[model samples]
Target chain A: MAARAARFNQQVLIDTTPLPDSIPKVKEIGATSAPLLSAAFFIGARCKPYNDDYMMCKTEANGRGELECMKEGRRVTRCAASVIADVNTHCLSEFRKHWMCLENWNQQLWQCRRFERDLNKCVFENLKLEKVIPGAPADEIPVHLRKRQIYAHSYANM
Target chain B: MPQDMPPVGGYEPIQYKRNLPARGFRPAYYLLAVAGIMTYGFYKYGKGVRELNELGREKMWSRIHLIPALQAEEDRDQVRRMLADKARERELLGAETKVYHSDRFVRPTFAVVPENTTD
Candidate 1:
């Protein structure tokens, strides 16, 4: 039986060992892709500084940044996870609606603009985290704020 | 041919011409209309592509910004495992032995999972 199981076992040794007691523990964010994408802008809005710091640490540490930047990394994780938690708490229905729409629409933002609007508004109002597409054209409205979506799967949402 | 005669105006001048007016727009007008439609379609297509590209950019940057933190998390677990394995090896063998031929530092990305069940 063990031989058969071993023959069939596909699990690679991506170890699950936790950080030791000397290192401060940070809980991993468990949200999957759709939910994460739905909350990504807000996470960026709230965690930009921490994220930049972590990236800087990684860049400065050369290849060894992976080990050297754990502290900055933990901060970034906590900030992002906190943003997700706050959005989950304050805008559960809107968040669900947007991500579910995202899941249904091949994760296309165009298809779920209405639900995203609701989520963006909710996150901004409740969590004070605004979704601004960085480096967007200044002369025109951002693509996300457009009233018409030419490529949407459904126009009713628009 | 039973003396068939012209009933009215010599059978309307034999009625050879297809007098039915051509339907729809004239060729030039229709071509212009089609060209207009295609141009508009291409314009809209361009806009959609541009929008999609911008969205892709946003998604990419988001992931890029996310890498450091996520990498750090994985590295922490890896370092912990390496330390734990080293401690265990020391306890079992009374001293640490090199597992690699080189003296240079090389981080192993994975380990062989120990099998506990006896076949």
Candidate 2:
């Protein structure tokens, strides 16, 4: 009986885990980008330095050995932890902007761009990360494509 | 033989005693057992009903349907076309366009920074 009950609970959870189809916007971005978008939601001043350092390692270092950028990578992880903790405390209202944006904009990143920008802006400013340029695109747009464009342009010039 | 037959008529039949062990519990104990089983059954049924009702309520409350991570073929093609168009636009621009969008960035609602941070 206990085993049966466990199976029932698992099925219920599985049912709840997927995004609903009513929001076509989420369906449009589909599954591939959802995790990235979700991660993007939490980024702010707390994680900026690490994110910047990692980007520098990736782009300037040309994807070489991370032996040079290990410190930055570690800093990013540490910053992420503290930043996540801080968000759970001070910036809940700002954080809610993303939630509200998800519901209001139907999970469209482009539409929620303002809310994400607002969240990161609010959270990071509180962490004193405002003046520094973010390594990742602070906007809702995909940063990888932009990076690729730069790479492609540079190759063409060469 | 005639004497034995005569003795038989005078002989009485011997009476035999039967012994049986007493029951440890009273009849009321059986009644209590039945009642306890019924109560357990009813409690389980009530819990099942409550769980079912909660599941129904959740279904009613959910506004969005669950969309799987996989996209439809047409949707995937659409995304590909959009990417290609963006790439073409970038190529035409020659210089990299720093601005991804025209939306004005919103300010943060909270501004209390933690100390010991380098700029």
Candidate 3:
């Protein structure tokens, strides 16, 4: 029975052995990370010369009379206002996408860490039980462990 | 004949004839009129006083009720700020990593020892 219990303990230890690289490290996304890289590429592709007429007017008015300066200022102000509005709209849209991505990443990381912790805890508990089994009282053995012992005995009989 | 009717003793000419009655009222009628006017005045004055009292009470109650509500609103704002700060702290500490354990049963002493021990 001692040998049998030792064998069962060994099996439990083997089953509860920690996996290599068990805990997943938190992932940090740098500037060169996929999400940021893709966002940059998307922005570069979507961006265009939005106020060509205003630019032309300013270029034509450069180093000219007072009337030209006034004209250039008006064109610049109008163009700036429109560009600001357009940028704000684009930023709002992109912000929502970025927020969702960050939220999803955070959730995934949380779940992964929780799973790793649970697995570690289970392994630790099994190790503790195996270490304590030799001095454990015969009648005081827990039902779950007793059931495992019974299963082992029956298997040995088979 | 055109004769001069000039009596030596009473030479009086009756010129005006009174047709309307006297303008003075009887005592009972005058008293009733005066009482009616006084009753109307008193009714108006009493109604005005009651309405003013009601308005004053309403204003006082409104002020009494408003102060607590405003104070409660301020207290709620403070509580909201406190909760916001706590939430910020939790966020910074990564609340998801927190462990929750409930230990219900006391672990058996023998279960924690080896059977090979003499004791």
Candidate 4:
């Protein structure tokens, strides 16, 4: 009876009734495990920069660098590129670099609220995960999942 | 007797009178001159008021925008000075200070001068 109750609790936890509103309609309709995993990954990446201390620290440092040296302002562009590359490579070192780039970007954004707004607008408008990531395709993924991924990429640099 | 009576009857008293010169359209001429002066005065005053108002508006606009820019510039200068002082202190202590670039948002062309250090 104890084993049966544990199994029931497990089943209850896995029940899909209380899904978030932000999750796309397509993800809900098809109800495939792959789409769910992808959505989770996208959300995780978007929220990563905000929560990670290392990324925040690096972002602050990068903001300082931009303030000090005008020439080094291009460092921001390079850092952003590096972050995208890291996402593609999926290497641990690349991941660390990606986080650092995000940290820098966030620092700059915080310093200038206008920059933050502009960056957010750009990400929201131009986010194409399938185009940025070679293997991914827009049609295969749910719309909310794509949005989450875009938000993640956008904030990743911040 | 007839001659005395005729002289008495014919004699009459003559009074002296002086004739003044006519002043033609004096009041009309004075009115026209005053009107012309008044019209010129109003035009000049209106023009002056308009120019003054424009200048005041321009000044107000400049003040509104200039204050913030001046404050930011002063803050930046102060920060630079403080950094310079810190660099001097490090030099006096013979410490190796790492120059960390601040990622503050400013124009892309501005360059900050680093403080002088011995080591």
Candidate 5:
């Protein structure tokens, strides 16, 4: 009887969503990625321009310890920093808080949870919608929200 | 073999130095070595921070511009596909590669059947 009830519950869950035929056609195209090399360059160059520049100096310029490359790297870093600054002006604290916690307590998701929540909230509120995750499960509330004690009980068992 | 020195035995008499022997390298060298190690450590730390920042920055920028840029690209590709489809449709309907100079812009001409070919 218990197994039959469980099977019936699963069937009910499956039937909750509408059929594909009934769903409206979406005109909007899904998001895509920036070119890999360009994206990687932007990221690497932005953070550590000197090192990146030094490498470029060695490879692209075919020289050793080129000061020009370092200068170019600095320029790139400055440009990236300027752009980042513009973005950061809106939610720097939130970004910092979230990123710092993530960096420090990487393996401890529970410890990082509040900071993540705060950051997500801040980003959504302050920045463009494009900056936010479109269909994040983090925002979802459980249908039968588990109590603190229930979480504690589970942790205790572990 | 000084007369005051104890005789050598299985347990040889230890010589006590009045003063410690001078180090092979100067104090300055040791200081420099320690400083070098510290500088290397700092360099490593800075590199790690930079890498971490890069990762974080990339993730954040992706959230902001990457999606929108990709969507715009997709939309453009879609439009191009639509145009291609229309061109194909026109071709099927036997529209000659008609050069209708309607405006300043010259429309792209598609492949047309030769007028002499009956088959």
Candidate 6:
């Protein structure tokens, strides 16, 4: 017998409505997965304050934060969007190369170290936004800087 | 035939050496070498696991930090759509109807209306 669903709702609704005039507007981020992963740390580095403020506002608003934290939310969105735009403008080639490598390599940073190094250098120099993993061990070299990635598919770096 | 047997010094005392080259350390030394290698390998493995753990932690924290900004973008989009749906509802039907029992951003079931059949 064929299965029929009655109680469970599996419907998805997509409403292409614009925000009302009462609310301010912000443009959503345009970059997809690979680029977003590659640029995440830099975005975190650049937007720490705004991000923290937004989170704090959300926490204070509790369940009501969705609508209440619009101001803080707008700041967070703008901060992230600005970081992405800046990177795209300043380090276009390096950014493209790194994200492309990431996309081809299952988004594994270890497999894309060479491109990542180049991208990091360019972003740091042009945007002054460093990619740092906060709370990483201070005594040892960061994973990104290691000469060999034990888990990489290719032995080229090793 | 002049008794060709027992020539000088009984046929040169019949040499018995096989000429095989001797090599390799004592068994105890070999054991020690294996132990040393294993110890170093285990140490390296532990170091690698720790590094991997730290990397994962760093990655998770990075994502957590980025969530606020990403969520803000998504929330804004949702808010825009909800507002748009509200406007559409008002245009199609002359008045807004209360559809929820409690207030917590319920995506209205009638938000996306299929083609109207009523003329």
* Candidate 4 lDDT tens digits, B1-119: 43536564686766566667867778889899999999999998885565444334433432332222222233334444444544555667678444547653344342233332222
lDDT of 4 by residue, A43-117 (tens): 223423332332334356663432243222223223333334434344334333433443544522122223323
Each candidate's interface RMSD: 3.8, 24.0, 35.2, 27.7, 20.6, 4.8
DockQ for every model comes to 0.27, 0.00, 0.00, 0.00, 0.01, 0.30
Per-model TM values vs. the true structure: 0.77, 0.27, 0.22, 0.28, 0.25, 0.78
Provide the lDDT at A52 for model 3: 34
lDDT of 5 by residue, A1-158 (tens): 66675443332321122213322233322211212211222233333444444446646754432323434433443444443453367667755665565455442223344544555466456543222322233544321121221212124211
> On a 0 to 100 scale, what is the lDDT of residue A60 in model 5?
73
Give the candidates in order of TM-score, highest first. Answer: 6, 1, 4, 2, 5, 3
In order of the candidates, what TM-score does chain B achieve? 0.74, 0.37, 0.40, 0.49, 0.36, 0.67
Candidate 1 chain A — worst ten consecutive residues by lDDT sum? A6-15
Worst 10 residues of 3 chain A by lDDT: A127-136
- Stretches off by above 4 angstroms in model 4 are A1-158, B1-18, B93-119
User: Between the candidate structures 2 and 6, which one is better when assessed by TM-score?
Assistant: 6
lDDT digits (tens) for residues B1-119 of candidate 6: 68767766675655698888768888899999999999999999998898788668766866776788778888787677666767777878889877777675665555465332222
User: Which digits, one per residue and each the tens of the lDDT, describe model 2 over residues A16-129?
Assistant: 122223322221322223332333424433354556556566467665423344445445544544544566576677666665655554444334544556665776667544
Docking level for model 1: acceptable
Candidate 6 local lDDT, A1-158, one digit each (tens): 25865563324344444677778777888778788888898989988999888888878877457778898899988888898899999999999998898898887777888888899999999988887877788998888888877777777522
Model number with the top lDDT: 6
